[model samples]
Target: MSWTSFYLIVAGLLAFTMLLVCWPWLRRRNSMVQDSLTNVQIVKQRLEELEREASEGVISEHDRRQASDELKLALVDETSLQKEGSRTGVLPLSVGAIAALLVGIIVYFNVNQLDKVARVQHAIDALPRLSEQLAAGKSEQFNTEDVRDLALAIRQRLRGSPEDARGWMFLGRLWMSLGQDVQAIEAIERALAIDPQSTATRISYAQALMVTGEAAKFQRAQEVLQGLLSENPENDNLALMMAVVSAQLGDADTTRQYYEQIKNKLPENNDMLTQLAGRLAELENQIQDVPQGSELDTTATPGFTIEVSIAEELKSKLPEQGFLIVFAQDANSDNRMPAAVVKMPLQNFPVKVTLTTDNAMLPSYSLAQLEQARLVARISTDADVAPSPGDLEGELNAKVVAGQTSSHTIIISKERK
Candidate 1:
């Protein structure tokens, strides 16, 4: 290609890119012009409302009828004037023509430039399999070459339409999956900045921060979440996530507080309530396994291992008082013998136990009992945490059958699409 030819090609490409970039603004402006025509629509709606009110005796029938008659006459007059104006010359015709011509020319040039860039992009090949791999969360699904092509596509698309919230979100996630934390943050942050009110953007941003362990930035994410919680306190998903994040941060008190708030705000059958219970159990387990002070030895096991898994259905039913500490004991003792204390978090959960067999002196519990032990939750308010609710006794018993994986499906809440 000669210099002029090369310049023309470049110009065409640039025009194409610009046209694509301006597409959103174009659509919005068009919508705005159309929306402006709805003033008449509002008047029509008001006319109908006045008629309804007059029929229902909510307003003076005379006033309603007069208002409706006036509205009908004004609307008809307006429509007739609009039609007349459309037919006859209504403004500075010469200036309006010039302005319209200029706008049309500008739009045409931008559109042409946009078309060239799109064509150039089309010439750049990509693999269909790459999209599948990306969907499957496989970073390795695309090699460096494939990544380059995909990356090019991403950059061009972003350049062409940076304000597209979904595109930004997707690119951010892709960067995260590649362990490109900084780039992911930038992309996701840009998306949020563009559409600050979008809940999906906020969630995706929070997830990116969590995955990257930007501990310092966590407070910002938490603030965003808290703001959202304040807006919709009964939002089960938000409430559950709030509790989970609290638990993860080693704030059991805060975690429990969030859970309680969620429970109070939500209905009796909120599904996220179930997740909150599981997270509560995990927090309880961690709290129990702690050695108190920070000074610890890595070399020694605490002589035993404790595994606690709760059945899904039972999770939501777990009270805030915490898990029931179960243990095999002398069936007749005043304080039942603590054969092996089983700390189970009530969430109507199935559990697993791994006792420390290192103490040869201690008698071993058979795997048969361990495996066969059924789900038993304890919150003996009189004997449970506090603020007793039941007249039940000190202990409850259940068995878990061995070699079985049992789970309860708990469907808590549903919202229509």
Candidate 2:
């Protein structure tokens, strides 16, 4: 309701209450005035009777005069008392009404928190306009102060309505846009807690986590994306984010798998996909130099030795004229280019390949320098570096400690569509 209308209603109620309280006092005052008038009429009638009796000689003139004086004195006393009573009654009523009004005003202001209510109302009214402006890409129209005010308003509203998930989500996004990552994360987390099944909230949470650029947060983002993907496998946008996160964490096979899922859905020559393809190619080249069938000191070179196998149900689908590509990429770098890669003609089941610094695509940044790397194994129907329909792939993430070698297995169960 508008403040004007609310104020009008309150004022009317207060006036009606005051009237109800004073009505009885006013009625008593009027009754006292009527009684005083009646007493004066009775005294005048008695004086007339005494004069009539004296004229008829029923009593001496002196006695008659004495009775008349006494009657007049009694009448004077009664009139004075009645006037005093009227004054006393009115004085207290006036005082009480004034006191009641003052107390009512004080309580209304203090207890009602009218100022806070006004602020909240103003904010509620202004929000849609501001949001519309932002949605229309006119965020430049709003200054920093405007955003701060809006945020404060939302907070005040949330204090009264803590369960509003959409409010929390909007607040989180607003903070994110302002580069307040911690606040953004906190707000988004609240939204997720309130409504765990909200896809938008989960996506926002993952984005917030990824923006922190911390390994732990990235891992969390990966888990969130994985959950979302499980629920919505056909969402190309989610798949795209999953691919990016996987690449950032150096999970080459998962990255490639996600990338391929969205590749067909996106426009040809998309820049993001092109960049991903280049990174994968670099990773493939790095794995090409690892030696085979020789017992080597694993401690001297840190990398992964992977065992690749085909799923039983898909064995009949394997192409006779195909090549196997195995690659590893640095997990921590934003560049995401492969540190090592190996490619060979398709061989028998349970193919074994090793990747190390010796297979580095670039000597400047090799697997030996990596703290972690992602391994991918793919069997493609053709020798092209880019994956095609019917390619089988799998991936794993492994630590690359200089004094240790990691071993993992990849089951090429998923086929590219």
Candidate 3:
């Protein structure tokens, strides 16, 4: 159920319960007033009886007079007692009602965790709309914070409902849009595990895997694409991806076959067709008469070249055996997972390093997919890739265009500890 609906239901029940709690006291007060009136009537009746007996000569004058006096006194005492009881009852009932209300409010707030519940509810309500927008290729149209909130909500939900395959898929795409390729891969992989036969899931998984710039991942992506294409040769998207993967793997024959199928399947006026034609031309120009090698050719790939150095003041703090880790990550994404990273000895300080799909943590993400990125260089006391206490670090942010080269410099001047 929607959080808002559940909250409202609980609120309604609480109101009903409060009224029930106070209802008995309210009825008791009215009953007490009714009882007082009945007692007064009985007193009047008793006095009338006394007067009637005196008139009828059934009792002596002194006896009748004494009985009337006693009855009057009793009535006065009863009235006083009733008044005291009413006042005493009112004070306790009022205080009890107030205390009950206060307690209920406290319980409601604590039980609901109101602030957190509201935030999670907002996220759940927004995720479907955000997914629709993203699927429409309008992700760029959303505010960055909105995107972040949507992702957060999905994660919150997945925590409780981990078996939701579609949710994982959405989360995967959302991460990709945010330039969190590693997380995207992790999410997509989860979805793939849940539903291995889903073509869409497999395709997304392959795409993410291929960007890691790792040879093994690239081969896996190629295998996935080939498997899909074998089922339907005219699947244009599948064929196109196969062509790209084959090209990356330096399999000219396979690449040409898939490229030809893609062209044949797409209409002549299709924009993608034109784009594919140009890519095919570029591939032909680059691969003519070239022999395939065990190592992929990354020279033609667009990426970044980073220059790293230790600040003069901090240089002495660097340990002789420390490892210098350099990496680039999406600048716009909150995720710290690197798109590309390399490690070297601290002796390589003041070194220039190239970052591309070749250095990707996964084959599915590389500098090629980023329009902007942050460059980081760290000197770790141990060879650990993760930054640890006392690690010296530096970073610089830069704007980059995919398929192009950019340069940036970072100086290690700050200690993580």
C-alpha-based local distance difference test score of model 3? 0.77
Where's the lowest-lDDT run of ten residues in candidate 1? 408-417
For each candidate, the alpha-carbon lDDT, in order, equals 0.55, 0.79, 0.77
Candidate 1 residue lDDT tens string, 1-417: 344786799689767866675565557556644654685788878988887887898999889878878877877787676556544543444456567657867887976665655544552445355667778899665665566566556766788797888778777876766556566778898988888888888877876665532223445566777878888887767766677665445456767978887777777676656656765665576567556666543443222223344445544554566554433332321111132444444444334444322211113222121322222223432232111233121323333333432332222221111
Mark the regions of model 1 whose C-alpha exceeds 4 Å error after superposition. 1-124, 127-151, 258-417
The model with the greater lDDT, 2 or 3, is 2
Across 1-417, the per-residue lDDT of candidate 3 in tens digits comes to 675788799889978987897788779878878988898899899889999999999998999989989988998898899789878887888898799889978886778666876677788789888879978999778986687778888899899999999889988977776656677889999998999888888888888776654446668898898788778776778888887766555455777787787777778997756655654554466555344685655554667788888889887787878788888877864334477888887785688988877888655456665667888888877554555557899998887674567787788889874
Shift of residue 177 alpha carbon in model 1, Å = 3.0
Candidate rank order under TM-score: 2, 3, 1
- Higher-scoring candidate on lDDT, 1 or 3: 3
Alpha carbon lDDT at 220, candidate 2: 90
Q: What lDDT tens digits, residue by residue, belong to model 2 across residues 1-417?
A: 677898799889988998898899889878878888898898889889998999999988998899989988998898898788878888888899999899988887778877877666777778888878878999888876568657867877788899999889988887776666677889999989999999999999999877754445767999999999999998889999888777656567887899889888877888888777776665555456444567545657787789999899888988888899888865665564567778899999899898878776555456875777878788876554344556788877788877666788988888876
Best by TM-score: 2
Question: Which candidate tops lDDT?
Answer: 2
Off by over 4 Å in 3: 1-11, 56-58, 106-138, 146-171, 179-199, 210-226, 229-417
